[model samples]
Target: MVRARAAVAGARAAWIVSGPGARPTMLELEHEQLGGSARSDDARSTLELSRGIPLANVADGRRGVALARYESARAESASLARALTIEVRATLERVRVLERGRQVFDRLVALDAEVTAAARARVRDELITPLTARLVELDQLRVERRRATHAIALEEALVERIGWLGADAGAIVLASEAVEPESLTIAEDTIAARGREDAPAVLQARARIREREAAERLLAREQHGDAHVAIGAFLERRPSETATADDGGTRELGFRARVGVPLPWGTIDRMAVEQARSETGLAVQDERVVALAAATEARRAHRRLRLAWSQHTRDASRASQIDADLVRVREAYRDGRIGLDAYLAEKDRLTESRLEGLESELTYWEARAALERALGLSFEAIASGATR
Candidate 1:
């Protein structure tokens, strides 16, 4: 009986081990298969997503390229504005110089008119010869003609300045001021340094070009043929046969994912990048050289002109003073019968010529100063204030 009980207990334990609850059901098997498929689908989707290009990088590069272009345009505009300012100031200064000279010529012409009238009266009264009167009239005419010609030149200069300032021919009236003496001491090294630091338009243009080229390189790097990824899902329904109990149908679901990359095959873009880089480098070196050479040439020329003008002005001023002193003595001698009217008239003419020369030299001096200002990219006011 004990052996029979042991065999029965062993059989019951075996049956319990292999019961329906212990075995996997059909629903559970289906769930396991679906879980495995879902895991595989997730992996495939992840791989596809990972293959996509970094579009943000490309967009950022493009923005950088645009910004570089804008910077180039802005620099060009600024350079143009500076050039215009220089032109305007130079022309205005020239107008002032010419006007001052014209005023001196006007005074000389008036004196000539008085002398010619006196000589004509003396001839009529039989006190002077007709030839002398004729000579005096001719001198008067010459002086008037010179003054008229100078006036025309002054008007033309004023018109030019007005046009540059964007004003109507008769609308703008520039303030009249006496021309002041410019500082005679300007260092060549200081001028060159200032030009390089703030006035070299070519250098600014070259830098802009370099920035643009660099931006282009960055854009090319980002846009080098990109990879793409795609994922899709679809559902389908199929009718079953013997659908009498209900509208029996089978459902199917499918998923797919794909990743692709462009073939690395193109030398044209690479060549373009190299070309841009080379051009940028060449511009940096060549533009700087050209600008520096031009600045040096202009500075030297301006310096020479200023020196010559200063020397001429000093000599003419001294001569004018001498002529003025001689004129007083000659007039007294003519009044006391110690000299003739012709000698007095001749002395007066010498004085007029000396004054004209002095005025001309002054004008030239101012013109030279203006040229130096343009070359150095600094005005007299700026220099006086110790501003760069």
Candidate 2:
């Protein structure tokens, strides 16, 4: 993103300094000193200054071509920025999901310890068989291993987030609560429409096509070449060689005017024009390809976002019910109404629900980010339900 912005700045500066309509006239100064000259009897010196103004730069339509190129650079920069934003958002969401998973696993590991201790006590009191106690211990070890895995995954995700957001992000605290799924009320047709005109990829391709078109026109105009007018004045001084000696030797002052008209018969000019025409045709084809791909991606993203949100909504509701069920199972196990195996099974169900919910939430957010990128819309705009 930083690099893209810097490129944009550089392009802007270049356009202002050297692009269309800048420094219309070229200026030059010349000076010469002669001593012991073959054609002159005395030493001589000359000074000349001239300005050549191009009269064909604007008339040839190269100015429009330069402007088109500048605009193309801007569009490319915008596309890069949008891609970066989408990537950053997806990475942040992934980190958040991993963190939540780690925390949930941590709590589960502690709960497993309590369950294992209780199972051992029950075995000592002869309330449960040794095999049951062994099973409980094995489940505790498994939970511990899963917790360790989550911890490692969380660390990796944090590092990834830091890579995207910079070192300072390492100190930033993420919210414990998960983000709710965004609503997908906008129609897929709207997204397809917007993507064709507003998506970064499509916009960039369109800009480049226009730039190439301008270049083609400019090249065609160049076949006639540019016209320039130059005017100069010069002063020359030398020792007088005439019969009569002058007060100040000899001096000559002269003015000159020149107009240049190219014959426009250069082979390079014809080749360049042909190349530009071929490139313009390629650019036109590229725009079509880009537009088609952009629209397809936009529709695909919209479909995925809708399905992910739906799945997340269902998972969220199921998770709430599982939470209530887990509370009852825990109470029943403590009250001796449920056996160790039954209690463990219920706990596993709750764990499955939590993990599945987390996965669904992550998927939903990822799809949302993808959709935002596809349509060239901001997160805020999507969240505000103004995707149209």
Candidate 3:
């Protein structure tokens, strides 16, 4: 937002500079004093105001370069805004994913505690070896360790979110907010179109190209050179040659005007014109490079998101199946049909499967966010189908 505001301010300044004007290249006021050599001499004073005007720009193309800059700055401001929004959204989703993952770890730790208790009871009853009980305790401790690690990561993610939002941590509440349960799917053509039309990098590059072109035109106009004109009125009085003479030596008051126009000399700064042309060509190439990169990234992100969603769906199904298996295994272990070790192993597998599913979900969201950035679409807009 700060960057966006700065860009907006620049645009405003450019617009103001580009306003209609026959701009004065130079303005001067002069003062002069003249004195005669003898005591009877009279003194003369003069004042003048003069200005230089660029004939080439005065009539039509005045500040054309500034006008082009204004347009470029306007586009840049919008691009900065879009980029800022994408950053915020991506950060928000990262925090959300980390929050969800923390919850999963929380559940895992609780389940590990229950399993450890059951393992200790089986050991006390002589149904399980002490080594087996120790293994369960170790597993429980590892889960606790992992939960601590996850807590640290979650805190870091929340801190990052706070910095991005410029908000207090207390104001950020995510537990009550429901997770995005489904993936958003946008058409490939829509993504491509958005990349070309709205992507911040592409837009900025194209705007720069236009800016360079305008600069070239302004430079070409400038080659005609300014017309320098100085017009002034002066007064002069001189002492009489002899002290007793009736007539003064001299007295004159007159207006003087001087004008200078450059001859249509050889090309003025051919190198500068060529440099401007080269810069414009480079800007064009830059736009193409940016456009190609945006298009490629948009396609790649879209594909990754599609793959993530598919993986999430498969993992979700596998987790559900593991959950069913765990229920049956628990029942069998209670009835003595399966050993406690077997039940514990199945429960561990269920935990792994659940974690896998959660991770897949996170991957899907990450990919979705990447795609949104590449296409220069906000998550809110995508979710609401605003672009569609």
lDDT ranking of the models: 2, 3, 1
Tens digits of per-residue lDDT, candidate 3, 1-388, equal 0111121111111111222455443333232234423344454434444455676663445466677778789877876777777776666766777777787777667666766777778878998799987987887787788778878977887787888777775476544222442324557766666776667788778878878987787777777777778776666677676646666677778887879887667464756878999999999999988888888887788778778878987886686676567566655654568775776777677777877787787787778778777866765665565652
Could you tell me the lDDT of residue 13 within candidate 1?
Answer: 10
lDDT preference between candidates 2 and 3, better one: 2
Model 1, residue pairs in steric clash: none
lDDT of each: 0.57, 0.72, 0.68
* Candidates 1 and 2 compared by TM-score, better number: 2
- Which residue pairs clash in candidate 2? none
TM-score of every prediction relative to native: 0.67, 0.72, 0.71
Candidate 1: segments with Cα more than 4 A from true spot:
1-52, 165-186, 231-258, 301-309, 312-388
- lDDT by residue for model 2 (1-388), tens: 0111121111111111233544444444443444434444333232323333444564548678888999999988877887887787777778877777777777677677777787788889999899988998898898788778778877887788888888898676645343453435667787777777778888888898889889888777666655666666666666665535434567788887778777757898789989988998998898888888888998898899888878988888887677677667767876789887789888887888888888898888788888888877775675565633
Ranking by TM-score: 2, 3, 1
Give the best candidate by lDDT: 2
Winning model by TM-score: 2
